[model samples]
Target: MGGNELPLQRIEPVSVSGRGLPRWLRRTSGPVALVLLWHILSVTGVLPSEVLAGPSTVLSSAATLIETGELQEAMWVSLSRALTGLAIGGSIGVTLAVIAGLFRLGEDLVDATMQMMRTVPNVALIPLLIIWFGIGEAPKIALIALGTAFPLYLNVYAGIRNVDQSLIEVGRTLGLSRLAMIVNVVLPGALPSALVGLRYSLGIAWLALVFGEQINATAGIGYLMANAREFFQTDVIVVCLVVYALLGLGVDFTVRTLEKVFLSWRPAFNGT
Candidate 1:
């Protein structure tokens, strides 16, 4: 053997097929399987159309609605309402959480009131909302805001408070001003938790939208579904439900992608 040469070892390429597919397809497998099973059951007459509409029937209904622009209009309304409410709620939540997390006096004044309101179910306030806001868009938007705020508040507060003392000390030692320390060290350190809160708040916003639109909306998916229910249009109802599920999944995927991008600086496996 040459003094500089080491023995060669053969290495086999690992098969990813055993894990089923690439990341995207793997993530979709469960929903695809469930859809296939649903189709099978529907075709086999195991599931009655009256009780539940199959994916095919719902797809057809959705296509019809889309062609007529009904679904598009309804979806736009719901999306606008949801986004508006989320913006309002998220801003309030982050502001309050930052205040309370950073200062003892702020916590004493604001945190307890928030905690009390958080314990009260947002849905339960619907009757009062209807009475106060008079079954208009205001009540619906308010409900969504209410639903979205609590989770963000809880998560953001926790995140800010949980920021490493060592980092804060280092920032101070480096002669960072209070605002500078918050912007650089505190906010960056608290970001993961804040993102988590954002994801959770988004979910709550969707749920709130669903409930809100069901109340007295002239348009929106919930209104369409409610109208369909009265006439026994199972496929349309299913379409509405499918839309909600897809929206939720899309939002979750967006947030997950954001997390991966923003948290790239952290080490993998609990940052160990």
Candidate 2:
């Protein structure tokens, strides 16, 4: 047989792997390409001048702010506020979720009130927060906490309540105490859901920063955006927004990595 004429039966299929790149990045490439195209159009004057800012302009503004330490200071303030609020809101939300999930009356008592609060926008409460806490870090943190609490509460509550009855029965049959069952069975079952809630609450805390900056005297990405808005500095605004997006992505990625590392028992984190 000629060397070039290899039989199909003799050859094993060589699989080409999409390794060295995350599946998410691969999936998002299409949208990123479109964004690049839009950016190019904006730079070339194809898009409306007022509505869209060129990437270069935004990058230049960001570089200037970074060089001047404005970006760093703003990032510190915003991240501090976000983390503090997340701690407070997440703690309370998880506490309430545990209480409500354990006791039926707790859910009944809190549900309607939480529903009412959920309907109320964090921005709307700014005036009242100012009156109560003054124009300080307290009010800003409180606002973020308020915005963050509901999502965590909802998700954690569902997680707790949705724990498999069969698992509970199995624990009971095994002669496990109530607390033991909760720790071993209920909490584990609910952990994945609670993680989802945690990630979501973190996002909401960031979102509430918009309302926080409007009232607060100074500092934070939100403040930067507000200041940029006043001067019609669209590039600065865009830069701050881009930073916010990156920070959110960073936080989410950290959370996801933690979940994968710690909760490997769950199929959701099987690396498949």
Candidate 3:
């Protein structure tokens, strides 16, 4: 008997039309609903304005802060510190990940130590950092750097190590030098993972900054929050929290956009 091939099943392409509201509205609906609910609750006295300020109260607080230039100054300080730490720590992470991933000796010497370091809570080092570097910008930046390093290192290392063996074989067969092979074959393949690390690291950087600034900050968002806490200014505190949320979301969006642009050659399901 002749061999028979099974028939392939038909698959329908995904559709967006009539599924829901327009994309922009769908994206924003959740937050809008939450805000409306919050306003309703606040109006009904289900939530106290002083204890847990509603969206309107928080918005008003933000406007007042902005008018006073307090929010703007605090934002600048916080952003500067975060960016500085990100640059330094991210550089170190990528460099070390590359070395450790590429060389057994480097892995043996560095990767274990970093793994141990990451296990320790970054905030625990704040006191030590203060003692060593004084209650200055140094400790804050250092804490942020520490927080920023580990995720990037782990992701980058994994990405490098996980590059397709067949691609490496192809590089060797083509008589590519070690440097050329890594640059052309390994790094490109590893970029997606590295970007993942970047997003995680950025998140941790903000968290670390929160702790770092709260410790002894003369000026920053954390300082503003601390001051608001002292007076029980729930509205101001909520404003700071909102700003942090927006900042984190902004950075994540930026990284995702960059990933899409750079990874155009790779076909993967990005939500349509």
Candidate 4:
């Protein structure tokens, strides 16, 4: 082969923009466009009415709901539940993860229970929780905490348990105290895994929110969707679903950004 023909050139791929927007539009791509196309076609009377109502009708319905401030109120209600539940659950989860990592007795006592709880659907707890707690924020928060706790405990426990014993021995040889060794070595070593637990726990928090808001809630996004269903307003349900999807994406983004910031010293593939 000639020198130039010895090897062909390779071109790096350039990602395309979708939905007349950036490629990062994520789940909004094909479905949103399809919905819009359906709406355009339907409103122009180009399609059979038996199939679906198009975008313009949905938009007008959405606009009407927004104008009455119901959407805003429902959004705020849902946001509040999600945020509060996250804070409470995440705090308990991380704390427990840390403690479980540090204490063998605690790990043994709680591991089995948490493993069992992990299998129990967070939503199933709603009925019992409503019965016991009367469908208040307390039960919802507890549910969120329950949903979030296990991953954190597992990661953190693994982090602490799997610490290099040699490192501890070196610290001992260096005459470092137990607390100092743990603080200086164990914590830093375990941080990446712990943060991963925290990140995954955020998704669980949202899942718990959906269930929590379903019981005795007159305000949350879930409640709005529930009420909308009675009126056969499919678009309103879609709006709530879109909000949840966006929120989850936003939270995952935040967690990843934090990982980049806090765990910068750890190599990419070096996770626990």
Candidate 5:
């Protein structure tokens, strides 16, 4: 090869199979394969229906529930509980985080107490909650709120603390007021970590809801599962489980979308 000319190099052709498929389909391939395997096991009697229903049966049961409007009502109740809990818990967490993160006195008063409380398992409080609030919606919502609060509190506090001191210096140099510095510089810097906390809290909220609803729930996915358990309706149970999983996934996706929108200016490393 001439010094001035680039040397000829071999280039590998892209695989036709991979290139032909959509990205979404490729991402879902593992789940699809698992479903296929599940179907095979179910049909071959390797996996008993009593233990776990096949996907088809689960789908059929879900459709019937939807048709009868049972699933819709359950979903609405469950979602309302989860969202209400999240709102209440999120408010408390953020408020405490702000106080503890920004002021030494606040930290002294709040952080230690929160740290102590966080160590106690939220589920372990179920009995106390039931006694305090009864088996109605209050205990369940409170459980979810308690489960969610700590994660957000921890993450937001850490995020606020870990913010680059240089940025604070810049804000000071620019003569930004305390409130302005927090609103503009501190909050923006802490957002990514807060979003991570939100994702975690969202997952925990679902788990909490699951456990909470088991407390003599009259309506909700947990109630459906409980009712199904009595009748050995494996398919309905599976459907409820799937719904819980999907709801968690949906909230996580929503947070991710929010992160992308809010943190668009920040550069991140995409995997090779």
Candidate 6:
């Protein structure tokens, strides 16, 4: 190469197969295919409208519900119940986890009891809840709280226990106080596991909401579905089911966003 001339760099062709499709298209293809098949079956009478509504019918019903504002009202009520229950359950779970994780005495007192309680199905407590709190909102919210608490407790406790011993030693060498060490090193280290617990708790919160609303609920998506069932409005029922799915998806996305933000310090694997 001449002193005044730039070296010719090797130019490689970009791989078309990997880059051709947009990520959104690739992600949506499976659901789109399933929907198309559903539409075809609905039109061909292999799937009856009475038994299950097609995607188009469901969409139209959702639109109608939106225009009427009933869907929005029901959604707000349902969302409130789910969030309230989550807050109560999550607070209790974290508090218990922290106490038990930090002290041997606390663990002895709390962990075994929690383990025993966790095995009992939340649904089995519904009758007792109804008797204790009556057929009102209390029973429903309590059911949700009971359902969400255990998964969070287990995960957070495990996370705290799993914190690296070397990091604890480093804190000791730095002469960090117990509170400071926990705040700066331990909590941060345990955050990824806490977030995992949060995701699982959020999913259970929705499921609990479903069963909770079944107990003489006058409002919410479950009520809407129950009413639709009486009239055989399969389209409306499908719309409610879709709404539940979309809400769960939205919350999961929120958690993933949180992981990106809070857990950014840690390295993670992204599949090829």
lDDT of each: 0.90, 0.85, 0.92, 0.76, 0.93, 0.92
Q: Which window of 10 residues has the lowest lDDT sum in candidate 1?
A: 12-21
lDDT of predicted model 4: 0.76
TM-score of each: 0.91, 0.87, 0.92, 0.76, 0.92, 0.94
**What lDDT, from 0 to 1, does candidate 3 have?**
0.92
* Model 3 per-residue lDDT at 197: 99
What TM-score does structure 5 among the candidates reach?
0.92
lDDT, model 2: 0.85
Model 3 lDDT per residue over 135-253, tens place? 98999999999999899999999999999999999999999999999999999999999999999999999999899998689999999999999999999998998888888899899
Every model: Cα RMSD to truth: 3.0, 4.6, 5.6, 6.2, 4.1, 2.7
lDDT of 1 by residue, 1-272 (tens): 56998778876545422354567787689989999999999999999999998888899999999999999999889888988898899999999999999999999998999999999989999999999999879999999999888889999899999999999999999999999999999988889998999999889988999899988899999999999999999999999988887888888899999999999998656310
For residues 209-230, could you state the per-residue lDDT of candidate 2 as single tens digits?
A: 7678778557889889888888
Between 1 and 6, whose TM-score is larger? 6
Sort by TM-score, top down from the best: 6, 3, 5, 1, 2, 4
Collision pairs in model 2: none
* lDDT digits (tens) for residues 1-272 of candidate 4: 55675566766534322335555575568877887787778878897444444566557767887899987887777777777767776677667666667878877777677677678877777778878888677787778777877777778778887888998888899999878998998988888888788777888878888888777777878888788778777767767887787888888899889889988887565312
Segments in model 2 whose C-alpha atoms lie over 4 Å from true places: 1-25, 48-50, 269-272
Task: List candidate 6 stretches off by more than 4 Å.
Answer: 1-20
Residue 227 in candidate 2, Cα distance off native in Å: 1.8
In lDDT terms, which candidate is top? 5
Off by over 4 Å in 3: 1-18
Q: Number of backbone collisions per candidate, in order?
A: 0, 0, 0, 2, 0, 0
